[model samples]
Structures are given as C-alpha cells and as structure tokens.
Target: MTSIGGAEMVDWNLAVATATRLVRPGPEVGRDEARAIVAELREHARSAEEHVRGYTRMFGEDADGAAAPHDTPVLVVDRPGWVRANVAGFRAVLTPLLEKMQERRSALPGGAVLGAVGGKVTGVELGMLLSFLATRVLGQYETFAPPSFDLPAGTSAGRLLLVAPNIVHVERELDVDPHDFRLWVCLHEETHRTQFTAVPWLRDHLESEIHAFLAETDVDPSTLLERLHEAGQSMTGGRASGEDGEGSAAESRSLVEVVQTPAQREILGRLTAVMSLLEGHADYVMDGVGPEVVPSVGEIREKFQQRRAKGAGRLDQALRRLLGLDAKLRQYRDGERFVRHVVDRVGMAGFNRVWTSPNTLPTKVEIAKPADWIARVHGDAGN
Candidate 1:
C-alpha cells in the first residue's frame, strides 16, 4: 500500500477493479432480448472458428493440424466484462516494463516514497485509459489471460470474447441488419484467433518483441524533457541530425514512437511489420467473405468507415492521436492493402511463405510497397 505523490504505481489489480465498471452502460435489454442474444451466441458456438478456418484455407493454412489449442473458448461479455478482460491483457503485456520501472525508482534516494507515488500515478493513468477504450471498441478478439479475479485453477480458460453490448449498440445505431453485422464482427475477430493459433511461432514472436520494447522503456525526467524539447524544435523548424547525423524521424512522435532507442526502433519496426500483416490479413479475409453471403456487408463497411472518421469529441480524439492509436488504425488499412496487392500478384499460396519463417516477414516500409517484398522474398528463394 506504499504510495508516491499520494499514488501507487503498481496496483493494476485495484486499478482494473475500480475502472472496469466505470464505462458507459449500453442500452438495456429486456429479459427476452437478453435471452435471444445469448441463445444465438451459444447456438453458433463455433461459428466464428469454423467460418474463419474455412476462409483461411485460401491463405495456404487450414484448420487441420493448426497449432492453436482448441481448449481456448470464446465467450460473450458486457462492457464491464470487456474492461475486466482487457485489463488482464494489459497486465500481462505491461508487467515487464512496470517491474523494470519500479526497480529503477526504488534505487533512488527516497526510492520507497517515489516508487509508491509513481506506481500509483501510472496505475491510475492506465485505468483511465482502459475505461475510455471500453466505451469505444465494438468487438475485440482478445487473446490473453482472463483477469486475475477469475482464476482458481481450471475455472476460466477463455481468451476470446465478443463485447456483446457494444455489438448491439452499433447495430441499433447503424440500423443495418443485426444478423449480418454480428456475423461480420465475428469474422473479423475469428480471423485474429486463427492467425495466432494457426501460426505457432506468431504469439511468441509478438511477446518477445513486446518484451524487448518494454525493456527499453526506462525513461528518466531529464532525458524525456530533452527529447521533448528536441522534438518540438523538429516539428516547428527542421529535423535535427541525431547527434550522430543519422537524421531519423524520432522528432515529435507519439508516445509509443518517441520512447524508442535505435535498437528498440529496429525491433519496433519488425513488430510493426508483423502486426500490420496480422491486422491486414484479417481485414483482407473479412472483406473477402463478400457481400453475397452477408447481404448488408457493403453498408456496414460504409457506415463503419464513417464511424471511424467521426471524432468522439476533442478529448477522445486527442487521446487517440497522442497514444498512437491513430497509427494502429493505419495498420489495418496499410496491412489490408499490402495483403490484397500481394495476393493479387503472387496469389495466396505465395503469400503463405510468410508464415513459413519469421525471416520472410515484411518491414514497415515494405508493408506499403509489396513489390519490394516480392522481389526480396523471391530473390532469397532463388538464392
């Protein structure tokens, strides 16, 4: 219960508990509608799994002998439930960074006092961030552990979920066919499931990169201030040659971008390429499912794009921009275009080579330029 600046830095358990329920409550359902939604979800238990597997066969990998453990169950959840789920994911991803940060603070003169306050502030900031996201996301193919609250051995082995309330809300607001929208959302999420599970090395590849990124995130006040000052000058005037004349693009970047060291930046580049591929592949699959099967698919795409374009007010939009979430959205677009172009030229079988080994993965620049990737990959094969 130690604290700094009247805050604790590492109480994610408490932060998640407090913030999970603070999200906007979705429209209330009568008992009948509730039962219907649940029943439909339950009835189509493996609908996403089955459909995604079928679609991905066209990508050169099928469900057969796929490495993903089938024991991972898909669950349906409300907004508060989604918050609980995501906080657990954040916990797993951020734990390494948090541990390293706390250790550094504890090494200071008033290490004890600073550690508590810093942990508290960081936890609170993260909680507020999660709560805000809970109010926005419609569907997520969550793949981390369940919240610490749910484990007592063999209790909840879940890693997949649909934010049921948000789905219903968007369906209502858009006035599109409910069934079509639900299926479409499932297709997108299920694609994520297949990507991680089917490709054995992918999950660990991502985990390792995240660990590397977090390991490099040891920021001190003076260094950060200096970076901020240099970044400001870069934006207002001109990009400075790094004291090394490298003249990199680190100037005035987002939170995720500015924190990188050069080595970490290379790692980040690889990760960005991989994530773009995953997201882009998923987008490609979902769209490829086509409007013929899902009648309102076109309308949903149009309305969804409109929704993404509209800002949720100044504060929300500002937060997304600063946090690099805007870049995240760009990943989907950039990735989809990459996948589509690659498939068009080389076909799905050729693209499947990417999953054969991490070495074949595209860099960030190559994601935007498929021909470069094609030439390099084909040349390497020739060698």
Candidate 2:
C-alpha cells in the first residue's frame, strides 16, 4: 500500500479487493477477473487525477473570500465500499424485472431494442445503456445533447459525480440478469443523466437554486450568542443564589438548529418539481419500452414502485431534515400522469416536443393540473 499525504494509496489491487468484497458475480465476469479489471481501471484513475484536482479547485475552498470554480470534490473511489454495497442491494431488488426485459426483447418484432437487450455488467456497458436511454427519451430536444459517458473517472458522467467509473466499485453487488435488470437500471440513471445533458440550463438552474437556498440558510447565530450570554449571567448569579448545581452545567450547553429561509423553501419546491418530472419520465419510458419486450414487465414495474415507495420513507425524511425538501412519491406519480396524459392526447412526438424550450416544460401548477396541461397541448396543436 502506498501513502499520499498520510492516506494509504488506493491502487488497482486494493480497488479490486474492495470491489470483490462488495459486488457479487454477474453473467459477464467472475471474482478474480473482476479484480484484474479493476486493476486496469486504476490507469484511468491516474489520468483523472488532474481533472479531479481541477474540480476540487473550482468546488473546493479558497482564501481571499473568493468562491472556488466547481466547489465539489470529485472522488474516484477505486474502493467505494459503501456505494458498491448499495448498488448490489439495488441489483437484488431489480433482478426479476431485468430477466423479464431480456425475454421481452427477444420477442420483439425488429431490432428496435439493440444495446439494451444484453445484460449490463461492465462500467462501459452501464454507461452505454444510460446514454442509449437518455438519447431515446430526450433525443428530440435540440439543446438536449448527451454528455460523453466515457470520460475519465474525475470527469463528469453527465452531471453525476462518478464515485466509481470502473466496474471495480459496484460490480459485485450487481446480481441481476445482465440482459434485463441492468437495462432497467441503465434506463433509470440515464433518464436522470439525459435530462441534465439535454437541458444544459437545467443543471445550472438546479445548482443555482440549491446555492441560493444554502446562502440564505437561517442558522441563528444570535440565538447561540444569547444562550451563551444567559449561561454566563446564570454562572455569575449562581454565587449569590448558592445554587451552583450539577444540572445547571447541563442547562448551559446550547445547540443552534438551522432553519430554512423562505428562499430555500421556494427553491426546494422547484427542485421537487424537477425531480418529480425526471422520475416520472423514467417511469413512463420504462413502461412504454418494457411491456412490448418483457413478459413480466408489469410485475417488475410494480415491484420497483413498491421498492421506491419503501425507500422514499428514509429518503424523504433525510431530505426534509437536511434540505427542507420532501421527496414526494406522489409528485412523481402526478408528473408521470401529466406526461402520460400529454402522450395520450398528442402522441410521443408532441410529448417529447415539450423539451424543445424551457418555457414549454410544465410548472408546479401544471404538475397538479394534468387535464389543464392536456387542454393546453391540444389547444396548441389546434393552433
């Protein structure tokens, strides 16, 4: 093991070891080979180091009160043990659905589904699947250009921070039939990736809103100061009262809780809407694409929905506590319903055309009023 700045150097071997422990074997490769592949993946990591530094410089802290460029650390965890474990868990839940997708793809009339039919086990394959799905969903939007998925680890995989670009990180946990479930996962991630890629402005928009929210974070410094002052006064008065008790010391301890400002709430509401739209689009695409190919598509879809609903409990709570936002499953449902209504009324072309401009996209109001959106779409078509 090498050391950089007292941190143990994470080479390909260590990366391989970490991955083997985290991921179970899929159809594509075995445990030993997985490690070897991860070893090869280290080369990419070295090249990505410069870019990682660049990202850090932009997103990292700087003196002189000047903001960094990116302000986010792009970590290439050759051994992201926890993330790999989570990926594996997600794979276990998604396996049955993936198998169904493969069977369904085999039965398709033509080669409409090309790349997706194969089981996805490698990083490149995963990237390809995501790219393909993104292209399919947001391909029509002129401004919606898919980002290069094959960039070195530190580089952006679209807008997502690539914690593990190689299979070494999360491959073992992935236990689905490569042909089916991997396709589904690819679709889910790519749905998000494509939205950001196609609508370039959306990435900046979301980040700006989040920054605005954070900037206005109303953590009352004065409250803490006041508490300290009170504690000081109590300590001085304690000599006169002869009440310097044990519980008195505990009472002096104070904590400051950060409350969300109005700006944060407004920004969070918009973010919720965007997230809902993204999830909704993925659900709709999965439904539209899977039924024709996968026999158990509906079952897989239901299972996924149930899994998401269950997972949302923790996610919703965490978001509300940390960011003052709720990850609304209902919002996703409503957004899906809205998109589906548009598709039903005007067809895929019309529904997809909505991405042509930022203005054409639905507002938070339109998410609730699917019928109104439908009427508007129909009315526009009539014009």
Best by lDDT: 1
RMSD per candidate (Å) reads 6.8, 21.6
lDDT per residue as tens, model 1, 211-319: 8888888576334334433433332343433434554323325667667888888888888899899889988887787464578889998898888777565345445
**Residue ranges of candidate 1 with Cα displaced over 4 Å:** 1-8, 42-45, 58-69, 146-158, 221-253, 379-383
Which regions of candidate 2 fall more than 4 Å away from where they truly are? 1-178, 221-258, 292-295, 310-328, 375-383
Worst lDDT 10-window in candidate 2? 135-144
Clashes of each: 8, 19
TM-score of every candidate = 0.82, 0.47
